[model samples]
Target: RAASYEEQGVDEIVILDVSATLEGRRTQAETVRAVRARLSIPLTVGGGVREPDDAARLLDAGADKVAINTAAVDDPTRLDRLAERFGRQCVVVAIDAARRLDGEGWEVVTHAGKNRTGRDAILWARQAVERGAGEVLLTSFDQDGTREGYDLALLRAAASAVAVPVIASGGAATVAHLHEALGAGADAVLAASIFHDGDMTVGTVKRALARLGARVRA
Candidate 1:
């Protein structure tokens, strides 16, 4: 998949090992190492990074940046020290958030979306940046895997609250959805099922986004 993305002119690739968190292990560096050799674009790998050393191991495995979520809530200070050790540019904070039952606000979810921390998603994004996370990968768990569209309110809140770049994830089923995400203040948009299931090509999506004034290049 990463190889195909590189061929389709994706700006970058983020490879995540979803099972690692539940399994209590660091990111699969070997998997990242293989994917790195197949693409020229920057790669960000995330999964079960527990500490700065785990992140460093990913970097050594050829990932340009390392993303973390469960650890972000379990030990936010780790982000501070990681930024100090590896520079903020190499740290990406992944936020898996779901809307409250009453739909009032978003709460942070960890452990691969199994645990919900009461921390407000918007507030957490701001804190991540302040702790030196260079970017935010905001996933709306309520919208994830549904292909309905992003949670524009959640995107807007996180993007506006943080100084760092925000990448919107979950539920990009159409070009219009991508446009809406960008318009809502997300710096980038990420889709999994659309591309993984062969519903859309990166080139086609990029062209579509460009028509919507996204400045995408061929």
Candidate 2:
């Protein structure tokens, strides 16, 4: 799938171990090493990264960037340290936000979306960027797997709070949702279940965004 997407002109690739945070799963350095040996495009790896060493190991294994989530929220300084050692461009912060109907605002979730922290998503995003995160990957739990649409409110709020590029994740049910995300201030849009289940293609989404007068990687 990576090769297919690359051939289709995808701008970048991100491979995350969704279970890494909960079960002590470490970054698959060997796997990444192999993939990097084969591919030329920039690559990002996330999940189970807890410290600066974990981030270093991934970069050593040829990953262009390392994404920190669960651990970064607990110690955002880790991002600063990683950036100091490897440069800010190599550090990407992934923030998983789950909506709370209690009107508490969006709370940051961790452990593969299983654990919810009371911290406000927008505040966290601001802090993450200040800590040297070059980009932020924001996933909306309310929209995950539902594909109704991205949580545009969350995307807009986070984008407004941070200066780094923001990638909107989850709830991309249709090509139009991608357009809405871009219009809402997302630098890029991420679709998992929709593309994984063949509900839509990345190329189709890009074409739709182009038709809507949005700039997308061609």
Candidate 3:
């Protein structure tokens, strides 16, 4: 899917295991090696990256960058170490967020949304950047498959909190949603089910984003 998206004029790709950490699965270096051999664009492999070794191994296996979620939330020093070793541009912090039922604002989730950290997403994003994360991938678990729309408020807050770029993920059902995400301060937008299931194409999204005056490579 990432390959196909790249063929469709997508700028970059991010592949997350999503269940690797929860299932105690190790990072798939083979998969990254294979994909790196096949694809020409920048690729980010994430999920189950708990330490700098894991991150370095993935990059050695052909990943241009590695994303950390559960591990970073639990131990932010790992991010600093990765940045110090591989450089900040190679580290991205992914935040799995959801609206707390208690109206405590957006809370960060872990282990594929099975555990809520009870920390504000924006606060955590700020900390991640301060601790040396180059970018943030903010995903809304609540709106993931619903395709309703992006959690704009959450994106806005994260954008304001971090100086680095923020990639908005989850609930992008239409081209309009892409526009809204950018308007809310997202530097990039990621969609899975919508593109994986053939509901929309990356070319369509890129065209729409371009029409809306967003910067996208040709």
Candidate 4:
């Protein structure tokens, strides 16, 4: 699957072990190694990365960047530690944000969106960047898998609060959705259902983006 996405012209690939945090285990380094051996583009790996050693293992296994969620939320200093040990450019902060019930704003959620930390998502993005996270992976918990569209409001808020690149994720169903995300201030967009279900290919999406006047790699 990773090789196919690469072949289809994906600029990068992100593999997250969604169960690692919930299951209390580390991301399988062997799995990352296997996937890394097949791809030439950049790879980002995450899940259950609690310490610098964990991130190191993934990097040694061929991940260009290591993403952290639960651990960073549990201790913001962990981001500092990771960045200090492996350069800020190698650390990607993965934030799962869910809209508040009052509809006021979004709150940060950890452990794959099962735990709400009550931290303002926008503020957290700024804090994470200040703490040395080179990039922000913002996933809208409400929009994930819904395929209706990305939470443009959330994307705008987070992107505006941080200087680093922000990758919009969750709820992408159409080429227009990706275009809207970019217009909303996302540096990049991440989608799973549309690609995994065979509804679209990276090449097709890039073509559509190009038609929409958004620059895309060939």
Model 2 bad stretches (over 4 Å)? none
TM-score of each: 0.97, 0.95, 0.96, 0.98
Q: What are the Cα lDDT values of the candidates? A: 0.89, 0.87, 0.88, 0.94
Point to the candidate with the largest lDDT.
4
Model 1, 47-71: lDDT tens per residue? Answer: 9987888998899989999998888
Off by over 4 Å in 1: none
lDDT of 2: 0.87
**What value of lDDT does candidate 3 attain over all alpha carbons?**
0.88
On lDDT, the stronger of 2 and 3 is 3
The ten-residue window of minimal lDDT in model 4 covers 109-118
**Residue 66 of model 2, lDDT score:** 93
Q: Which residue pairs in candidate 3 have backbone atoms (N, alpha carbon, C) closer than 3 angstroms, thus clashing?
A: none
Across 69-143, the per-residue lDDT of candidate 2 in tens digits comes to 988988888988988988889999999998875966799988766687888999999988888999999999888
Candidate 1 lands at a TM-score of: 0.97
